[model samples]
Target: MINKRLTFCHENWSLREPFRISRGVKTCADVIHVAINCDQVTGQGESVPYARYGETTESVLDQIEEVLPEVEGGTNPEELLELLPAGAARNAVDCALWDLMARWQGRSVPELFGLEVQRELETAITIGLDTPEKMAKKARMNRRAPLLKVKLDQENILDRVRAVRIQAPESRIILDPNESWNMDILRLVDEELAGLGIDLLEQPLPAGQDDGLREYRPKVPVCADESCHTSQDLPALTGKYQYINIKLDKTGGLTEAVRLRELALGQGFGLMVGCMVATSLSMAPAILLCSGADFIDLDGPWWMAKDREDGFNIQNGIIRNISGNLWGGTEKAEAAVS
Candidate 1:
């Protein structure tokens, strides 16, 4: 048996600016970095603890600690799903195990799963919630971006989206209400949002309260974010959402995320791969699922004040390349993290 060791710690990276969503504002991304060492090789993964899912830095660390012995004792990602429910803790460990296995076999994670990596992926540049004029200003700045994800809330929904649509007329726009809107408000702005050329509407209604969606069909395609976590949640989401946003943090890790993608596709649900405001380490694993994704929102690293060295190169909403030294690649060892 190979001797495996596990080490993890909490890290906080400051954002370039306040990232506001329907829930609240975040100036720093609190993440947990997990490293597994075996046979003189090391694998690493990162996860963000989101309070919206009842997760905090302390809770995530404690959860990882609970499984430390099992993880070091050769617990694989498949067994990990039975150990922990889908969440941030499992996400960190599952991804690390995948990295470790890939390194052990002298292959990249995508190769291990028989996936061909895309040289370039067009991602969505996110514009956080702010005043209408401010949002428009941000949109204008990123007008050249291929896709723009605009955050909104119940207040001034039409004004904010319209402002962004006008500023970035050529950009494909996705409106993310983040579960802040109800059916009444959705009906109120559905026509105007479509007229503004909005491409997608994400999680407009709060989870468990989205039954109204089954009866009301909007002009724009709707996606489920907060409403869907794992494959178990997919059945109920049918007829309620046109697309499902897959985030590793929500699915526990790439292991389950890949399964969720296949299952969602089989069920006729469109796929959107997204990420929390984290470093490239967290985004790297999720990149494996972007091959057939309808929308890619892995622009988390772009919001950071500084990212890891050899991180993803993202410009104008396009991810040019993911360095080999980054997570899940076979070309080099794990990138140094400070």
Candidate 2:
């Protein structure tokens, strides 16, 4: 006789505060959290939409429901891989299996994936889109983080950087325009930012317009985010971007992310391991990519009003697992989630 199957569910989460960027976001987030329960173990994953990318949690949850029958009927994660293409659904299932397997077998998921545990990492604190003054204030507050990822738009770009630089004069800085930049603004600000001690500039040009970058000369190194999704995006970015920001959600999950890393590095591209707004579980898998990354910007959960009970602890720009469960902290997490 076959054993009883597990339970599955997905829900929405709201950010404690609106996370503003160059585009327009002024309120709570509609996040999707996927949970899988089996026996005494449970695994969870989170997914967020990039409206610019045309994704929504409702659509993602609907996609999961479409596959609910198969998931309930003992379809394994490996099977889910072939049945479903990479996206939020496959990512949730893949990570849920990683968690379940780790718990049921008393092994750590990273170990299963052949990744070593990192004791410490210097993450880039995100300076949300704001006035030059407010952005600088945020940057000043986290000056000790060693690195800062400044979010910007086409408007008042110089003013914002000037303010932030005054406060965190010595902090290594990088800029993420999120494809809000055009050739005019990009070329216009390159010299100012390069002079301001900005080490790298991220996604200065729009995704489809990256072809223009071929003839362009950057004042600083340009890392690809929106322009670099899967490994297939690598060839197109050649000679255009010096680095690629690898987010698990964008690549689908940890499995494909690893493959994308190898392909990008082999083709001579730098790497930045990033994340959507997610709890530690989702960020943990991306840490592997950080092993060789030039920059680490995994500050997704920091914006949460109340992180999951057993979530990661952020202190002075470093992340540490508190519960010590196979995936993260369980005692603290279980007590909170339970």
Candidate 3:
């Protein structure tokens, strides 16, 4: 037991603009930020409660508050896996623990895991769900981005994707319906998706409705977002999804995310590292898992009105690593603590 203290608070970050998906719209990102201080070093983590996963901001805060005693008493991150179920609450506490451990060991999580941190991670800039014309204008503005994730719904799916494809002709597109599409819509747009140069289609149909994908093959690779969580989901996702979007919030933090990635790869599923709208504190841990991922959507901070100081830099479409004790990197952590 290293001398430790646990503290948490809820933060609400107003987005520069409202971000919309099929389920709802968010004008701000509400997250729980947890900081663990072991000795003199303080490490931070953040988790956004997703309504899709049955979590609200208040519920997440309450969940963390419930475990304060155990966390302060010296519960390690590995032990945390047994404490909470996989969701936003566990994600906040688990990552905080990882951050604390990294600071204590004087190593970044990636270095601790013997993984090379990729200097530049190419991330897909998201164009949230909106009218085709508005979405197209947004796409044109980000034309320099190499990849564009176009959020869609049941209505005007082809028009929106086509509009973005036309505006950003060079960008590889990922169409994320966010479980708003049906088999008919998928069938209707099957051929056009490949023509529109959509490299990946994410969570087209609602969960449990995905069994249709077992036999219904399409030209574009379909990635699972809503359908997959941890390694336990691999069996159900097998033969249905070609890719799995891994988010720390969904996997209960980097611990399970790393495990899920290894298991997913062994099962022959392509990997994608993603994030909800969050700050760099949340994105930092996910960056460690970005190695060899087929797609990276950790651009949550890009949509924010402001970001933490020393946050990751986005030059063109490439997200460069940050140099600070934001979450990882021992030298930076030491500098921050000292």
Top candidate (lDDT): 1
Q: Give the per-residue lDDT of model 2 (tens digit) for 1-338.
A: 02324344554456666778777774554556666666656766666655666666666777777777776666766677666666666677666666666666656655566655575687888888988878877887898878888988888988988898888887888888888888888888888888988888988878998787888778799999988777878888998998999987787767678889989888888889888776676676677677788898887777776666666777667877634363532343233322
Report the candidate with higher TM-score, 2 versus 3. 3
Report the number of clashing residue pairs per model. Answer: 1, 3, 0
Q: What count of clashes does model 2 give?
A: 3
Judging by TM-score, tell me the better candidate of 1 and 2: 1
lDDT of 1 by residue, 13-122 (tens): 99999999988999998999999999888889999998999999999999999999999999999999999989999999999999888888776788777766676789
Better of 1 and 3 by lDDT: 1
For every candidate structure, what is the RMSD over all alpha carbons to the true structure, in angstroms? 3.0, 3.9, 2.5
Which lDDT tens digits does candidate 3 get at residues 145-190?
Answer: 9988999999988889889999999998899999988888898898
Greater-TM-score candidate between 1 and 3:
1
Pairs of colliding residues, candidate 1 = 91-252
| Stretches > 4 Å off in candidate 1 | 332-338
Residue 233 Cα positional deviation in candidate 1, in Å, after optimal superposition: 0.6
Using Cα atoms with residue i matched to residue i, what is each candidate's TM-score against the true structure?
0.97, 0.89, 0.96
Please give me the total number of clashing residue pairs in predicted model 3: 0
